[model samples]
Target: MTVLEADRLSADSNRRRDPISSRGAARADTVLAVEGLTVGTGRADLVIDVSLDVRAGETLCLVGESGCGKSLTCLAAMGLTSEPLIRKSGRISFLGQDLSLLRENQLAEIRGRDMAMIFQDATAALNPVRRVGMQIAEVLVVHRGLTWSQAMKQAVELLASVGIPDPAGRANAYPHQLSGGMNQRVMIAMALACRPKLLIADEATTALDVTTQVQILKLMKELQAETGAAMIFVTHDLGVVAEIADRVAVMYSGRVVETATVDDLFERPLHPYTRGLMACRLHATTTSHGRIAAIEGTVPSPSKRPEGCSFRPRCPYASDECMALPALRPIAGIYGADQHRAACHFAEDFARAGS
Candidate 1:
């Protein structure tokens, strides 16, 4: 069967299984809601009008190339955006509380306790001078009111829970002493130390080897399931998205280009950008030419983005109509019932043609 046919079948099956898939129900289940988020420096916006929501116990993967603003969005959600770059406009609500209105101290209180993030580089995020156990213990000490001795004891158990070997001994090792995978496991232990309601993993497995990456992904999924926490997993790898994402938001040039369930995205990608990304993945047929398909032209820098669709210059299907920016709108007909959205003038046509 063709991709569109598969998407139709999947949608039909989902509808049959859950007849009351309403926006109201979705909103009620949301653990984090971000709307009209715009992060920028004085001269240019790095992340523009991005809105995202993750339901309780859901994994939302934000996928894009290096400069596509995926990481910035995650940082903004965590209120960790620092100087030079600022959140110009947005409302970030966590568990129905508006985080934008909270002070840094207030946000700090919620951070490790209610929401936590695992940065892209675990070694950099963890302190070199501090023992791994002390780092994890710090969270429990600050947020859970545990004594240093008690916290350190539990820290070893946390490390063991994340599959670290000889956790008691390993906890005493400094960040630099551990290998990449072990440090990442330590970071996971720290993030989950507080049993956060929301977990944002920004390329948590990007630096690990294939075997270690798989283990980390499996560990994360198991932990998330156990705690019933919502997750925002950021990555450029579609393979990772397929493994972990319930839904995906595809971003390009600082704006969200498409959003859909994982199956719908892989089966019937509507936006040209999303399709380009999918095509870029290596497959058996890709060996024919000894050259992989690639989206032409690098993502335009935020400062140099075109007046219309930021992707217009690179989009093969660009036209005069595309000179006007397209809002991220739902596709018409059956796809609309699934809430599949794409920001492209020809999304409907692309969907119809199954391109």
Candidate 2:
């Protein structure tokens, strides 16, 4: 999607829509609602008390540095978490169905049909030997119960829909033969084959070149608009967020520090970490070489996530009030329209600081 498209949507989106915490009464419009989600091993919590929701036809971008629990959150949402890491507490409801209450057999029925996911690495996600087309056709065969030949025919159409040239020829190509971009497109085709109502993309465009990344983002937007599939797009790159997100959630060390509409976030970032990220983006473009402004410290280790705010150590605005973790609260006076929220004790001060 282009900047113009993003700006138009940002302007048109109802900025007054409340954050998930306040929208419990009207979750009927929500496609995926995650509340108080905690993912961890017995020893430590990797993702703690995180909550966010994706409504019908909207895109919610999860942004943070690596190890901020972005991918783990997606893994938990999709029931793909391994045995070592368990969902310690939380509720993940997709289309009003409680995912935790579903059995493995029942979950399988929804995995590809009602909800689908695209991994960050396309090369590893695709089978090395199987034809790309067959991989997609398999989803249709399993979910739609289409015959082998019928599924194969549909696979070609799916590839074409995602902008792959000579769909029939590319359909038979092996993963090893296609470029990274082609394989990524193949992965998308498989994910969209069933036309899932909810789609989770984990940094889907990170591996491609700029041109291909733009193409893929545009294609995802177009396809999403056509299908009205609510999306949870996990990405650390704010550039992607600007181009695609309707809402943005900033996560810090296993927790969401801020949640706001894309316009609100770019205009007045409340958390220090979020402000630092935007600074980094500006420095990267205004100058070249080694002078880029970056957040001072790495994300805190989950096991030792500090006494108060996890970002306090790196935050320039930290005060004695930050001795305890701040609740994710909506800005005061913005009552009823509880959409913009921040977890910083000094969020109001920062919001008033201005750009």
TM-score of each model, paired residue for residue: 0.93, 0.93
C-alpha lDDT values of all predictions: 0.88, 0.87
| Backbone clash count for every predicted candidate, in the order shown | 0, 0
lDDT of 1 by residue, 1-355 (tens): 1332343344332221222143324467689988889999999999999989887788889999999999999999999999999999988889999998899999999999989999888988899999999999999999999999999999999999999999999999999999999999999999999999999999999999887887898788888878889999999998888877778999999999999888788989999999999999877543647776899999998888898999999999999998899999888754544568899999988888874
Measured on C-alpha atoms, candidate 1 has an lDDT of: 0.88
Q: Model 1: runs farther than 4 Å from truth? A: 1-26, 336-338
How good is model 2 by TM-score? 0.93
Clashes of 2: 0
